[model samples]
Target: MPIYEAIYRSNDHEELITVNSIEQHEKFVDVKNHLYCTYQGCTARLSYVPKGKVRAHFKTWPKNNHIQDCTDYFERMVTANKQKSIATSTMALSDKHIKSVLDNLKRKRKEQESGTDKVKTNRKKKPRPKVNPDSFENTTLNIVPTTGPEADLTSGENNIKEPSVRNRSLINLSDDDLNWTRSVECYIQNVETDDNRAVLELRDGNYTFRVFFEEFFFDNAPINFRGYFEDLKYLVQRHKEYLFSGVGLIEKRNEQYCMLVNRGNDFRIDDQYIAIFLQNASA
Candidate 1:
């Protein structure tokens, strides 16, 4: 039996709602009447397996006759075929069949190369804009302090205040704010580290911003402060909840906002910070 943990209810719907959306044993009570397999021409009723019973998931009804030849059924058939192929190493082949296979490989290689060449020829490089150093010489960087319930003392540090301003979504930032320092609290969705830099993809609701960290900052940071970066990386990789604070330089690339953080900026991470920055933005 092929077990599916998620399924679409309608053709027009884009998101997958899991059986875990409902409480344990409440799945049937809540959505049994509404559930349906998304596959066309299949009228299989999805059975919800609640939590604590071999993990919560959705499975096809045992007596679903329509699902015998559906997409999931075909996938299982393909998987079984692959397993059979792997198990049998020796297969008889005629000389003509071998020649046809070699010709197909050559044709595929030529098509791939031609496609790569076309992509290279059509790609255009955008020039980098020159920056004027004088424009930032006398700029006064304003630090806005966060207030209300979400502005409480964060974990791992004492006396540092969280920002209170609510309009910190990436979509709300503009090109005019470039080089200006602003505080944004975002959830770390992704983290990537390389030899020279570390990048963090952060999200506050539908808005997303990238945080850039240069290798110099980590290498030159004091020993006490250096551990914060490692801790942050671990938390983000584990998908743990935390609020990130830093003085960000907003840059617009392809109409999307990205923040650049360099050495000496106030970058802080606190898992105990319970204030929802997204809720404030919406309010």
Candidate 2:
């Protein structure tokens, strides 16, 4: 989420601050004070991005903590809706499911605000995990195959083998079967640099699927493309295991399958609230 305003908290005072205001009074602000998402009940830290070619703004990290009903929280929802409106035919998840989830969360928030929910009370916020940069220095990448027939790594332009089941691993899906709506797992094989673009390769069994982060990819992305792409590279390089869930169309080019990650909410890395790999990656 591209947060514009943030909550500045200190021992003596708490106040709402906007990116513009922060810039206006940059020298007078206390950097040591805690900066959080402006929305009530949201604990996501908002890092200030000073004005450059673009205007100053607040940015959330990969490990952001936002309440489900926060406006910043709905950025992903906006992406989902935008994707649906633009390409309803390619979407895998049902609209009804998304709407139901939103409605339930809104109702729950309302109940808590009205003092109707007795089970809920003010509780201490969980401490954010500390990441150690030295830990991932010498880590070896390990990819565990799913329990089934050993994936055949056949040599050819089209390495995918037709899965007997409709809902199957991503690598096991053929060009024709990419439209089915389901949660499928794939192994993070590699991240490669292709000219000005980035390519993420996911493998299952012997077949590898590629997702290209090119111009079209950036057009649909919700965050800063360059910064987020760097974060993704760092994430994949540091973590050995992660899961990516999203909605997109699968295109076959030159006998190879490529996944189009066209929306912000269309995918999650490690079942995280956001797309970047933040959950358990440091651990």
Candidate 3:
């Protein structure tokens, strides 16, 4: 949780103060002695610090020394995801699932562009397979893909249905939430590319997030996606309003949350397969 307010306790009185309230005064207010964490059940101390470039904000005295449930608490994203993966039987995004989702989106897009509904096929439907509630693969294999306009692209404030595979927004992500693999959504604000790697600066509201694709990732990727960085730049030039949703672990690097695209199947653009869409556009 983004803590805007903190509790101040002195002798027998306890009061609430905000970072903005402290900034309004000409001189810095020294509340380090009395400032307590605003999170309930969290007694960790806080200190106000002014940065040379960014706005002043409260920080835990010992750094991430907050209650377990608090967002600031430190935890390894990889380790947490591994544990959750076992419990949920959730594995990395499979090529079959990715292709199914993208194909579904492409069909919808074509229908929209043509301004026509789907033509009924004369072929008989196959027998439906029974799904196991505890089996992630069995459940997701039948997922009805959501399209660009149909997908819920809003910030993660609403109590959206928490599917077995969670979709998270960087703005509302917490320490506990990052424990599992998440389908994180953010818009690409900028892209930095070099021969070795490419980093996409993403944003959701006022918060900034990043997606990193390294040389190894590109080298191992399929033929169509080897030049993925260039395609991302092309999309930016077109001024297309699109959302980048990558399924990965959210890791904090240099105080910024970043998603490392470890595999090709884990990435998507506006609910469509990244490689397929980029290839079609290039053609």
Candidate 4:
């Protein structure tokens, strides 16, 4: 219990009055780390007090009367710190999700090493067929970009081509997996831990686009699709147009984009919307 020396303005005039107390000073400081100082002319000794209590103190003090400017400083600092704390909390959720994914992968690798059957009995292993003999146009997941609110970092711009040619990594899955109607394999393209989304180059070889989200991740994840329905619908419809345009000219130009929205799992937009548009537009 250390004593605090405060210079407070008297109600009658701008003159300062000294208040020496251990209890009152401790009571005024609220934040985890309380910093204190007095106004230019007025000497007010503030202490460890809850914010609510300080507001209550403000009410009793006359608004027109000479009051300590320290209150205003405290309020501003408190507001800024509160906003920072909120941002910190929101970012933590992504950390938890990523940690879970990595943990699951590790667990999966261990299970496989134990000589467990990794493939399901109903599923058959097929060799990678030459869908696009060039091999450059076969990869479904090219680049991972940011999407949604600043949960992890920032949302991705709606672009098809990436900007520059940096270090790029690609993984090609068997074309048979894409053909399978019963099951779909999802590839989640994640940004590096440095908090940057990878840009993807388009099939044109010269042009590239930012892949914010692909159908596989969207279909597999539990998402709140209230606002994302339109974006998703627009994305799928654009690809189907390419698939059927002028005797496969579009597919030859941008590659085949066959998207199937699972109806049973749709939480927001109607799953049939993309299908209906594709059907009508294709004919």
List the candidates' TM-scores in order. 0.34, 0.38, 0.46, 0.17
- Rank order (by lDDT, best first): 3, 2, 1, 4
Q: What is the per-residue lDDT of model 3 for residues 94-188, given as tens digits with 9 covering 90 to 100?
A: 44554544454455556758987444433555544444445543122122222112233222224333233455556445555544455566677
Query: For residues 1-283, what per-residue lDDT tens digits would candidate 4 score against the true structure?
Result: 1212233333432322223232233222221122223446433244332221011112112122224454443221122222221211111122233233334434544675797624432245453333333333322323322112333332232333321111111111123223221111122222111112111122322222222234443554545432233443454444422211000000111453322222212111112233453355446
Write model 1 residue lDDT over 140-250, tens digit each, in one string.
222332211132233212333222222244434555466444445566887777656677788865567888766555566454334445555665677656656555456
Off by over 4 Å in 1: 1-167, 223-230, 271-283
Model 2 regions lying over 4 Å from their true place: 1-167, 178-183, 193-196, 279-283
**In TM-score terms, which candidate is top?**
3
lDDT of each: 0.48, 0.51, 0.59, 0.27
Residue 214's lDDT within candidate 3 is 79
Q: Per-residue lDDT for 97 in model 2?
A: 38
Note the clash tally of each candidate: 2, 1, 0, 16
Residue 102, candidate 3: Cα error in Å is 8.7
Cα lDDT of model 4 overall?
0.27
